[model samples]
Target: MKQNRLIQNIILLIGCLLLNSCYQNEEYMQTVQQNHLLIDIKDSGIYSNEPISRANTVGYTTTFSEGDKIGLYAVKNGEILPDVNNVCLSYTEGKWVANSSISYSEDKVGAIYYAYYPYDQALSTFNKTSTDPFEALVSSWEIGNDLTGDIYTGKDLMTGFANAKLEGRNYTLDLTLGHRMSLAVIKLPTTTYNFTNAGMSSYNVSPQNISFTIGKDSESEAPILPYYDITSDTYRILIHPNTAYTLKGKFTNGANANKSYTINIGTDIDKAQYAQYIVDQPEIINYTLNIGDYYCADGSLVSKDGPAPSNCIGVVYQVGTTDAIKNDYPSCNHGLVYALKRVEGDPIKWSTSKPSSTNWYEKYGMLLYNATGVDIQGYEETKTWMDIETGEVEGVDINSIMKSTLNDYRQNFILPSTTTDWYLPSYKELDALNNNATILNTQFSKVNGEALWTSATKDISYWSTTIRRQDAVVQYHPDNKTKAGYIRDSSGYYRYSFGF
Candidate 1:
């Protein structure tokens, strides 16, 4: 009986071992049938002026550059898996490898994952408990939000993601990595300019190492720093994407070291287009910052409005397009006689508010009205201010009258040339100067002759100029409220003024 029992016990033990072995084999087969994930990461590589192409995929030997950290995450249906382990992939020996706590998988399928270069410290604690992949990313990784921790290094951030879904075979996930930041590339080609030293113009060394900011103001939220790029041979800086920004900078010259410059970026920027889905892609947005052709004295960049004129202050005063002035003039002109600077001393009286007579009003008044009899007003003053017709003056010339009535201090001053002849402006021209007061103030400021004088004297009242009535009208300020409407032709109280 003892021998039979021993034999039966041995058989039972063998049966248990075989059953365990079969169960293990079945579990292994089930694991093999589970779905795998393959993330084919890509970049659009859209650079300025470059043609668009296919998306670039990160290859086996591809990895983030030094100082670049990438953050990634996996998702399935909606929730983030805490047990999935790694959320960050580091660049090591030109290969993107899983973090210390996670194992790299070459298999095509797995759980959802999230990864970013220059990993986000703000979401370091994110794991299985986190739900909603899109919501999590939007909340934690906002473009301008703060990413705290030693891992972030406060550098520009890049991001990518992969969704979690079971696949019987390799499931290809075309993941795109985009920059949450932007860059501005500026190029200052070698240029030769004559510098004026001690009232003389001569060649001088061009300035180098300009400091700049890429926003509306110095306190802007999205500021830019200019750096040099070797490959493209230009200056570059990172900026916020999809936002309007102005390029501003400062360069030093002699005593003008803090001169500032500003230029508009026109539109928001998209991503930089790199080569077609190739390997060894750098994480950056290449934006070619346009510096225009000319740099103004105010430290601003301006486009080349044709060859700059000589013997002028370089301020383009666009005038002459109203009433009797039918001649087509240049869109921009050099400061012919003077700019709106504060000139000191007494105000010179223009003329008396006489009746509609031939001496002054009839001769100059016709110049203020169209040939078909349209009284020029401030309706569209910018379009009409330049309409002074010297050819239409029947009697008293506008330029001669202005010179005779000007204060003795300005009697022998340089007169306006044929191309830039100065003359008393009508109601429309005066209004144009007032409308552009802000721009004028920014460009020029003089203490002595800051006041404006118009050649419009009306017979009855100040409103006469507006109604195109009997000619004698005058205004002390741009508002047209202050006036000496009843002054005499010999009235020294009013001063002579004209537009160039």
Candidate 2:
């Protein structure tokens, strides 16, 4: 029984040794899988062979050798394999690196974990028992050009490449160089002065002193430079950054008078400012008068000869035997002092009588008259008269007879005055007079049906001294006479005289 126990102990000793060897191998594989140099290909099925396993070693890893065609398989779940159907291969540092052609499948855990590393053709395959083929390949390969420039570098098989510089580094790039600038210039309308009638065709005006301020808005805090030119009495300004500017000009005239004008130099100038520059000039003020006509409120017209001291054109009238310059008269008599007619319309009657006063006749005391007939009650009174036997007298104070006869004449004609200034009207004055023939015939009476003579005459004949058509020849009379017209029968026959 002791001999049987010794044999059993030897068998136990062999089993313990084999168990220790397996445990050591497993631990070494796990350590290789966790190496930093290995690109994690566990989730990348980039080859059509088995994953990195103890069973397949040649397809999972490769080493670079001249003219070698090694197929690289991606790792998936800590195993290198050639089972990746959708896989692609690329060269890095003269070695074939592998990656999955398709994006990581969302259903797989850690599907983004894929990797490859520099490899060589000589070491054509990984050991069958090795767990990390990517780490092993990296350790055996030499680095080459990473393809990305100085800004980036390759870090690991799975971590691919990264920007090698620090964050927030500053850089500048010129998009375009040696470019030409384009500009637009808008000219404002100009003002001109002209004097056509005054014999001035053109006049010279001086250029105005002006200034401009540029800004973004009317108010902005940017430093801007301005450039300008003045040519042909116009101002041209250019401001940097193509912004808005305010412009002002000061102008002075020959008379030393000064004025200021403001404008805007921008895309949109104020409309009112532009309009003010286009204003219209004012008109001149001067004129003349015509001759031979009197300037009146209504207009000009032909004038007439009038009186002196107050040289105004007085109205004209005719004189009759019965007309008088005094206001008092016979109770039944309504005589005229002078007969007048208006140049406009029908004749208007006027008198110098004082209302409600008996001293009216005394106011016209300078008036005188004569008569050669019978004695009348007011005879010596020199203001009344009576018919007496006729006698030829050169001059007589037959004032009473004349006054009474004059009173009768005044009452029947159009008269303007009763003062002694009343005289027989002139020819031109009478001709211009306005008269109504219908009224005149009805107002006057003729004794013995005889027309009496007036103070107005032509040559030896007693002719009416009224003007006609601005001429002196035409006269009115009852008897058509060559040189003498019958006034009354000399005591029995008709007689004529040159005096009224």
Superposed Cα deviation of residue 336, candidate 1 (Å) = 46
* Cα lDDT of model 2 by residue, 1-500, tens digit: 88998999988999999999999988886554332122212212112122333243212122223332223333445454434422344545554344543222223223222323322334444432445443454443322212122211121122121111112221111111110111112223322223232322222233222233334346543322222223422222222222354545453331123455445544432210111121123222221111111111111111222111121122112221232322232221211111222122221121111123223223323121112231111112222212221231122221232233334544443222212322333222222222422222222111111212333422122222221111111232333322221112101111111001
Off by over 4 Å in 2: 1-200, 218-232, 253-257, 264-500
Q: How accurate is candidate 2 locally (lDDT)?
A: 0.27
Q: Please report, in order, the local distance difference test score of every candidate based on alpha carbons.
A: 0.39, 0.27
Model 2 CA lDDT for position 146: 27
TM-score of decoy 1: 0.35
Cα displacement (angstroms), candidate 2, residue 292, comes to 37
lDDT of 1 by residue, 1-500 (tens): 99999999999999999999999987786555443333445543335423332333211112346444455665554555453434555556555544543322443145556655556556645444554333344334433322223322344445556654445543445566655554455544323232222321222222344566555334464444444434553555544554456766665432222345555654346433222111112222121111112223322223233243122232323322332232332311211122333223344433322344434444333333323543333322222222433333334322222234333324444432212233333354345445654544333332222323334422211111322323334443554433434323422232222222
RMSD of each: 24.8, 49.5
